[model samples]
Target: MNIILAIILLVILPYVGFWKLFEKAGRPGWEGIVPLYNAYVMIKLCGRPTWWFILVLIPGLNILVFIGILVDFVKSYGKFSLLDHILAVALPFIYLPKWGFDKNTKYIGASATAPFREKYKIALKKTATREWADAIIFAVIAATLIRTLFIEAYVIPSASMESSLLIGDYLFVSKVNYGARLPMTPVAFPFAHHTMPLIGTKAYWDGVELPYYRLPGLSDIKKGDVVVFNYPMDADSPLYRPVDKRENYIKRCQGTPGDTLSVVDAQVFINGKAAPTPPHGEMSYTVQSDGSEINPQLINDLHLEDLAPGINNTFTVNTTLASVNALKGYSNIKSIVPTLSPKGMEDPLYPVYPVKFPNYKITPNFPKFTWNLDNYGPIIVPKKGWTVKLDSLTFPVYGRAIEIYEGNKVQVQGTDILINGKKADSYTFKMNYYFMMGDNRHNSEDSRFWGFVPEDHIVGKALFIWMSMDDNASFLNKIRWSRLFNIIH
Candidate 1:
């Protein structure tokens, strides 16, 4: 389910009531069923040059061209009400047929012609209602374009990037920072993402998908950029979606394309060099107290995940290093140490992805990996044109990416690998890939669990926090006033 030439959807809509419309216009009704010819006939019926329909293929001009043709066609049939024009695009199947089949609705002439417009100028005069409607429509379109091509507002929905990006933090993401990805699912409802509100149906139609394309960016996605991207796994939802319509996920890019990334004892390393950890990044730690019940207020004040009771006044909690150091000064706190899963140790609470295989025999036929959340790969991020040999070891690491993300049919049979029905020893990546991980290391479901995020899944770079709210706080203290307009690191 990808692109369909784009024009077929907004312009031709041939399978709709175009046949009846064409017949009423003194043109062969069958012409309405043809592809490009139908669109040409539409422009011709609107008294527009047939060649003007070519603008329908042009990205920026397409919407204008469609609107013009729609307005002209409707006006030709004496349908001039604002509601009529709105439904002409919003519910074209119903409106087009209603207009086409109605005996009273007759084509006056080419309503877009200069002579017709001059004659109807007084009739087209805007009422106060029409003036407001036009202004609001223009505003909606302008805002939509700005949000699509420049920046968009996003709210942090989870504590995955807590301490850095808190839940309820509203931020502006800059599409220009890493290039604005053109909509792959183009025919979606305004302001609605994948799902319609209340009714819970799909908000988009897959009939008008566009191929992945990006405008030139100010810079490439670099390490440490907080990025909002389409969830590569399609995320928590069971229902699948087109790439751009997939759930938006926010995470720090731990590794960019072509970088070899690894997590050693909870610290990230890129190309054998230790990368700087987020200033307020949190991880699970074992905290032993001096046989005193630690203050519950301290836990809430520090924003620790929770203090799970254990023997000997010890507890496991997730909090930032700064908070851990603050607790060290308290007499009741015995020791605070980060909880790490030793090289061969796997934590039930922090299960790593199967790509980091653990139990397989290390033979030519099988591979073994004991990687865990706290200790992960030296896996290479796939760059465009980068090819890697596929085998037992690499299959688990990159197979899903090669097959699903890159679109291929893969099969394995007794030591032989088949891609697209042919034997393939290697695969060259069609797009660059990224490795994303959240600030809350142990508690985050991230690239460590899934795998690489394809370039097409990128949305934008989070620019700054515009507003922040504390949902658990009292009404008077709800606003996180200090964080407003703070630039995202």
Candidate 2:
């Protein structure tokens, strides 16, 4: 409904403003009020090929297409100045109608036609200022189109995806893999994502958000694929932003829609089976030594993330199995075991800034379930058309998803669940959801910490690492040349 209103008010009104202008161009005035037909007539007036109209159908590309057509349509009336084109796009409801009413604004000829170019083309050389301005505008538009509709470059800023995707690794996330999601927050500053750099203000307007929509994609997100998605937590609260404008996070898809998933001592089981683990994945381990401090150099060699010395000469470390095996070989090492949280123990860091979760916690929010970080639910991931009984247990697990991400008004009173103001015992999911976990399990702030990632929040599949830089390495050794173009697992 908002999209239709936006089209009627912002889009169709411009064509309505161009009614007289279209009639002057030898087309019927009624054609201007007709949406797609108006664009067709405008293309004819501007002498652009009929195929150029396809741009109007593409979601991300249409913004550029609309502006370009406006510029071309205005130029057909001998309005060639940059200001004229700018107003034609920026204030089309005002300037388009102004031109439509101005008798002096003549339908000179098709804007870019050979005959029109021969007659009205100025012999004066374009000023250096104009050339630079034109170049910058063209570059911005071209880059925006490419970034939106095709592959985009992403840099790993944290060790959440360490090993499989290291910090400082520049990856090419393929939009086409799981389809390019249309911009929900369309009125955003170009290149600036959710926030304006330096100023620390929002870069997008949420007043006119479009619905969650996606173009056709090569494949669906499946298990083991390293995927990039909008951080689902940003859907509400003090950090709320449009889904597309949410912070980008990359993780390995461990559980897909419809699959029941559980974590037992940090090992994920999907649908009653042990899921395939990433070769580079790491997890927390408690390393006990025979009251001896191991060599500091050996600690660095293991590439352990956390190496906090515990009481009784034990060390709580986070590292891959390879590191654990290497540590096992040491003479002073007594034992190394996974630091699993015993069943029902709440994570000490829960419901806080460092550990960002929903408004409520486990027991009070939902039914009493003794689930913790290392040992969690055998919860079913929601799939489209899947219906669940909306009670205390299910509501807490899926309430945020039901009311917030899926766009519904969910209210709980006594023992009754009300969705969209209607008392309902069950709710059908509108979209599929996935479980994402970082390869660096203990260190990663991922789906395990938050919840399931909605299908709409999915961005793209990580294709490969184009560049990798090691910040800790010396200048000469900084370039991780061997990892370049390595296909993401």
Candidate 3:
């Protein structure tokens, strides 16, 4: 008797729940949970050609079929108007029941078709309609809140900010360190964010100025700070905005508003003051994976090279002139703040100033890029009203200005001001972004080329390392026990 009851519940409940779905599809109620038969009825109600579901398994054409399913499903049931149809497609679960249970008296059919399915077939359903509805809403809400208010997860794919952050290191970025942005683009169906992509053109159709609003969070930004922000170039990827709550980056903030920054001999000097290097723990003379000895300076496998005019060429130093030139270019060592140099300012035109070299190279087994990191800078971060003539330009050194608006839309143009196809004398800024780099130096590709990360793009500061694993390591070395619970300062 128990087995029979279990079978009955399993077979009977879905039909009861999906009876409304059958009616919405213009089919008889009993056809609701009849797998193959209901599929046949759905094809009939939507007026689809036979075997369309089979074609839906095809890669590219599946998208087109899904679209057709949405369109036909809505039109066959007159419960939803045109706008409702659009909203339902973006987020279907919201209108599923309406299509199911609504008593709207219209169901269109061609050539006198009957409403009921002929037979029942068993099939596995992925998720319940109710669960789907809740999941969609939950994901969107959680993504938004985590993007703005709490912590966000990000994976590092490249070695740009290496040493400090490895390629496989996944991070939880905190948004509370700064602040979050309120959701402005509101037309998304509870779960469907598809329409957001096609919404490239702003909805300025209403003719009212949509004033930008910012939800205040952290009070200040500090230099040498490691931060995560949105990628300014690709705002439309997942989050619709360049600086998003969705995508994040981990970098050290080298410049802030109103602060002059310059790098001299690879040393970063902010606002005419020298930036302090993080304290290096004791050095270990262990051999690395590549058979290179891992010494104190090799804690992160840092390579230091001298790019000085007369220094790198010394025979006793055992350095290559080409490597030195590469160091000069990579480190921007010709100028005190090489990264901040304006574009077209490549030649060493500035008067050479004497800089004292640290004795890091004296240590045997020290990497070649050490001297590059030893250099300091003296430059300033741009403020709202500050103006300066840019003679030369440098990539990754300068941060561009951007204006973020209500619709997850953004406009980016910088101080090398261009206006209406002409260059302007001075430019104004809506918000400021900073350039960040990793201590790994040579391995990290950062603001040095892509551009400044705006305040709105900032995701959060990294607080700690909770879990870590290196797939290449042995079982004993798999877990990064020393890094576990380590505070990210």
Q: Give each model's whole-structure lDDT.
A: 0.82, 0.82, 0.47
lDDT by residue (1-489, candidate 2, tens digit) is 777866765677676677889888888899988877788888989998889899888866777887788787888888887777667765686787778888898787777678777787693236788788778877887887778878899999988887778889999999988888878877788999999999999998887778788999989998999999999878768988888999999999999999999988778999999998788888778889999767878877788646888899898887888888989999999999987777667653233313333333334445665566677788898999999987777777787888788888877777777778899989889999998988987678887668889999998999999999999899999999999999988
Residue runs of model 1 more than 4 Å from their true location after superposition: 1-118, 235-237, 295-297, 347-365
| TM-score result, candidate 3 | 0.48
TM per model? 0.80, 0.90, 0.48
Local accuracy of candidate 1 as per-residue lDDT tens digits, 432-453: 9999999988878789877789
Candidate 1, residue 178: how far the Cα is off, in Å: 1.4
Cα lDDT tens digits for candidate 3, 37-72? 654566666667778768666533444455556555
Give the C-alpha miss distance for residue 198 in model 3, angstroms.
21
What's the residue-level lDDT of 359 in candidate 1? 27
Minimal lDDT window, size 10, model 2 = 348-357
lDDT of 1 at 154: 96
The regions of model 2 sitting more than 4 angstroms off are: 1-5, 33-40, 49-69, 90-94, 123-125, 291-293, 348-366
Better of 1 and 3 by lDDT: 1
